[model samples]
Target: MNRDTLKNWQSRIDALSLRERAFLLLTAGLILGYFLYLLLIQPTWQALHQGRAELESLQTRLTALEIRSRDLASGRATPEQERLDRIAALQTQLAERESRLQARLGGILAPQQAAQLLQSILAQTRGLQLRQLHSHAGAPLFNRGSAATAAGPAVGRYNLTLEMEGGYDATRRFLQQVEQLPWTLFWDSLEYEVKDHPDAMIKLNLYTLGHS
Candidate 1:
């Protein structure tokens, strides 16, 4: 406000009685607090409420799916021939999935390749620093058929753990790059902690299946 108008308002406040000024101060404080809640706290609470609701819905769906899967496996009330037919169909689907998985993965000794690619991407990310890159021993994928045989084509899953510290945007870009790689990757887990504002520590565990 211009000087004269501001002074007029100040004089009017000065003319108020002690109890009147206290009441005005309290009213202003309440208004400020309400605005602060709207500007800062309300959105966080709304997000948390919505997230909890979604989680509950997902949990309900997951429970039903788990029950169905158990029935498929045990076939407690199913006819003997029907159970056998379901088994055959599941085995066929498994074989087809395995075939497609093999086609997507054409490399061997995947851990080293994964590490190299991750390092390259990390280097390219401006605000990210790599603290650790750990590669675990490969776990072989067994053939799923009437008979479990190792004589079939050998395939294994390579596990890699990546630890880094970076800004959120840079880490998000790095993850996107990893996802867009030519080979398929199974995401095991991801942990992100923010000890400092706008910067976070990230731990990512990933695995890929390929020739042993």
Candidate 2:
């Protein structure tokens, strides 16, 4: 059903006037751009806010507990030995929490490695001309601390946007190859314009997450 629908749309697009095709492409681009912003950016912002809240909550709670411990220690009302034991117990609790909080999330895809992989894939796709490539930093979903001290945790998603010009088959093959890559790539937006006939312009925005 989807393939037939796509064929129908392709035929319809092929039959449209150049100006109408351009307008359609523009509309599609706008829609896809908005979709990408919602998919890639909004979720990250939400996760970041949640992560900050969680970390801050943890921090505040620990602070409050430490302050209380100190107050009990400074007050002669509590025995020194008991206060020391309480402080030691709190330190152990903190260590255990930190160790558990660093739980592994998922696979890691380094920014440099991702870029290199993209370049290699594009090179293999004959007749595809890479026009532009851009990178964006990722926001951590949660804090990832030392692997030595605690369990290795997952990192954030690193983003890349690429623009290329190629024949339909080449562009299609390139996209397919990217999909086959081992990394966890999220295809946020894809804009393929065929106004110029056999050769088309393609804009691709994708993000890959880091490892465990």
Best by lDDT: 1
Candidate 1 displacement at residue 23 in angstroms: 99
Model 2 agreement with the true structure over 53-153: per-residue lDDT tens digits = 99999999999889888877777335676677776666566555544543432344566688888988999889898999998777854443343225344
TM-score of each: 0.48, 0.45
RMSD each, Å: 24.0, 34.3
**Clashing pairs counted in every model:** 0, 5
Worst 10 residues of 2 by lDDT: 144-153
Task: Give the clashing residue pairs of candidate 2, or none.
Answer: 107-210, 107-211, 108-210, 108-211, 109-210
For model 1, give the RMSD to the true fold: 24.0
* 191 Cα displacement, candidate 1 (Å): 0.6
Q: Candidate 1 on 1-212: residue-level lDDT in tens?
A: 89999999999999999999999999999999999999999999999999999999999999988987888787564568677878877767666666666665664336567788889989998899999999876766755665222224556777899999988999999999888877667899999999797899999998876665
